[model samples]
Each structure stands twice: as C-alpha cells, then as structure tokens.
Target: MLDYLVFIGTGVYLIMQTLGGDKVRGLTIELVRFTLAYSFLWGAIEKFMQPDLFYHLLEEHSYLAMGMDWEFFVRAAGFVEFCCAWHIFSGRAAGYAGIGLMAFFVIAAVIPFGMIDFIGHFLFIIPLIAVLFTPRKVPLCRTACGTTLAFLVALALYLLVAYAAWYMLYFYLHLDLFH
Candidate 1:
C-alpha cells in the first residue's frame, strides 16, 4: 500500500542518513529541512483555506479551547506555521523553528489528540529532530544575492511539487484530504 511505502521509505531515508558519511549527512539534513519546509508551508496554506477543520478539532478536542472565537485560534496557528515554514525555507533560525514546532506537536499529542495523532505524526518528528541536531551553516549559496535567488528557487520548486502531490491525491486518488 502507499502508506506502507511511505513508512518504509522514511525509515530507509533515516537509516541512510544515520549511517552515511559527513557529506551524506549534510545532504540528508538539507533534504530533511526542505521537506519540513515544504510540508509546513502546504499545511499552513491548507489550514488558512479550510479553517473549519482545525476549528472543529480545537473546539472538540483541544484542551486550550478558544470558545466562541475558535476561528481566531485556527488562523493564529496557521500564521505561526506559515512563519515557521518561511524561517525554515530561508535558512533563518530554522533549527529554532523546528524545535518550536516539535514542542507544539508534543503538546498537541499530549493535550488533545493523544496516541492516534501522535502515531500519525511520528514521522514528522524525525525531520524536526534531525533539524535540531544539524549544525547551522550558511546555505549552499554563499552570497546574499545568491542566497535570495536560491531561496526563491527553492520556494518555487517546493510549491510546484506540493501542488502536484495535492492534485494527485485529490484528483487521481480521490482522497478527501482534511476531511
């Protein structure tokens, strides 16, 4: 199944990174960073577009309920996620963003959705952990201009890939995402 492939592929990727040499480790870390950025960006956009899903979840399950203004909480959360994704993508305090997101997930898993959400999001924790452990170095582009160009290119590529994946899931597979 596709789910099994994802799990196995992730495990294999992590294992490769763990046993890899220094260059391999660096590449893998960058890969993980890009992946986290892409995922968070997509998630933030989805939350902003379809806030009712998160609003309902927070109202029904979250311990820190927002009561009548639940939509505010949803939008706030989406904004934070968007900011974190930007930070990660731009190589600006990316590790801090990863750590913050990790903490948020820990709280969410404990205070709201419990084991099911925890298990479902367990794979997400891996990249965050990797980002936390990875050293903060200059991005592949050394100069300011180069860095800006690289960031723009990376963002564009990530958005395109994410959109393609979404299209495949929604149109081809007929998966009812976020429902």
Candidate 2:
C-alpha cells in the first residue's frame, strides 16, 4: 500500500541522515520529527473518532487489556496515543514515544489483524530504532520559520494522504472507514 511505501522513503531518509548527511541534516531531522508527530496525531484522532470500532476489536481479539473494561481500554489507548503524540511533537519524550507506540501497534493492531496489520502499522518500529540510534549532537535548526513551515507542510501532507487513503477504502474498496 502507499502508506507502507512511505515507510521505505522514511527509512531511506533515515539512512541518509545517518551517513554524513550534513547537506540538509537540520531540515531532514525536523521533517522526520514532524511527520512522525502528525502521523501519531492522526492515529489518536482516529481512535477518538471511532472508539466503538476499537472497542469491538479489543472485545473480539482481547489483546491483553489487563481485565479492564473494553470502553475504558479504548479510551486509555486513545489518551495514551494522544499524549505520546503531543510529547513527541514537543520533543519532550520522543524516545519513550517511539518505544511505547511501537509496542502498542504490535499488541493492538498486528496481533489482531495479522500480516496486514504488520504491513500497515510497522512504520512506527522504524522510529523505535531511530530514537535509539540518534546521534546525541542534534543539529541546530537554521530558522524558526523554516521549522514551522516544515511542521505545517508535514501536517498537510499527512492529512491529505491519510484522507485520500481512507477515501479509496471507503469508496473503491467498499470498506468502512470506522466500522
């Protein structure tokens, strides 16, 4: 799927950043961070928008919700995701977000949906590795305006592509967006 391909692109960018990428390191890092933040933002919003869908999935598959009520589990999952997304966007706890979210996707989506879920949601794992391997000396941003522009652009792109993918699923593929 197109979303999975974006992972490949992200991986390539990550690789470039790892290997003497002084050409655009600041911009690249900012873009990667913002893209990831916006991606998680979309994820949290989707869950909040359709809690019943996740609740039913948890009810059916029961991914170690720790004996919690399904409704509470859904809300907690959304809140966790929302908070993590904010923290990552704010650069407060990106490493923790990467680790926690990678585990969450595996436990919540991949375990229930099988290979398709892995294919669709495995991108978060890359961030797990990225945060672990990031160089300590982060490059200083060239300008506040440039950083802001990248954040806005990443948000727009993430929103547009996500909705476009949802549209294809809802229309051409005859799949429910939140069912």
Candidate 3:
C-alpha cells in the first residue's frame, strides 16, 4: 500500500545525504521506517490470522517444509515478524531485527514466490536498510514506565490501524486473495 512512499523516501534520503540536507534526510528515513514497520506489522497480522493458508502454501511448494512441523513454523514466523515490526517501530535494535527481516523476506517470500514476491518486496529493501543503519535521533526510552506504556499503547493502537487499512483495501482488491 505504501510502497511508493518507501521508494520516494529512499530516493530523497539518498539525494539529501549527498547534498547536505540533514533535515530532509532525517525525515525521509523516518518515512521509510514508518512504512516498513507498517508493512511488517501487516504481514505479521496475516501470518497470525491465517496459518492454514501459509501452511498449505509451504506444504505445496516448499521442500523445506517436507519434514518439519508446519504449524509450529507458521506461528514462529508470525512471532518473528511481530518482533521485527516492533523493533522497527521502537527504533531500538532495529539493525539487528532489520537484517533478520531482510533475510526472512528473501528466504521466505522472494525465494518461494519468485518474481511476484520480488516485485512486491522491492521497495522494502531500501527501507529496511535505512532502519538498519540509521539510529533514531530521538530514541525511545527503554527504562521508563511511561515509555513502556506508550510503546504498548502504540502496539494496541496498531490493531485498529490494521483493521482500518484492511477495510480500506477491501473495496479495491479481492478479499479472497488474502485468504
């Protein structure tokens, strides 16, 4: 949904980096971060919501899923994506998480789905790199109770955001595609 924003933000970021527009560069990076976080969170929601779809997909196409437990794998994948999303949002340990996420995207999505997945995920690559390398300017507090509360609140709020985004896309695309 926000693929364009990621692409444009990344371009502006690179340009600003070389041209000395510090504020513009920072803003673009933030834009990339927010979009990537949203994308990862949405993907996690899908994994959590429909394990059967993912399971059948892997079983049908992936040789790796031949002997492994599909159910456990799906849940674990969802949890990993959720963690990646949260780290991206919190801007804490994002580099660590982002690298894992990029690998996951390549191994899980692009490799299995091929060209379609590659095209869909192309914009994500740069944004993930942005979050991976650029530390947050105003970092979120990890020690404070209020900061913890705020982060939790943001997580809860994202549920509604996800729902709203779903409904917004419902009319434009086939809902059965996600199923």
Top-scoring candidate (TM-score)? 3
What's the CA RMSD of model 2 in angstroms?
A: 6.9
Off by over 4 Å in 3: 1-22, 62-69, 144-151, 160-179
Please give the lDDT score for candidate 1: 0.64
> Using alpha carbons, what is the TM-score of model 2?
0.58
* Top of the candidates by lDDT: 3
Can you write out model 1's per-residue Cα lDDT over 113-132, one digit (the tens) per residue? 67876777776776666677
Q: Rate the local accuracy (lDDT) of all candidates.
A: 0.64, 0.61, 0.69
TM-score for each model: 0.64, 0.58, 0.67
- RMSD of each candidate relative to the true structure: 5.5, 6.9, 5.1
lDDT of 3 at 34: 73
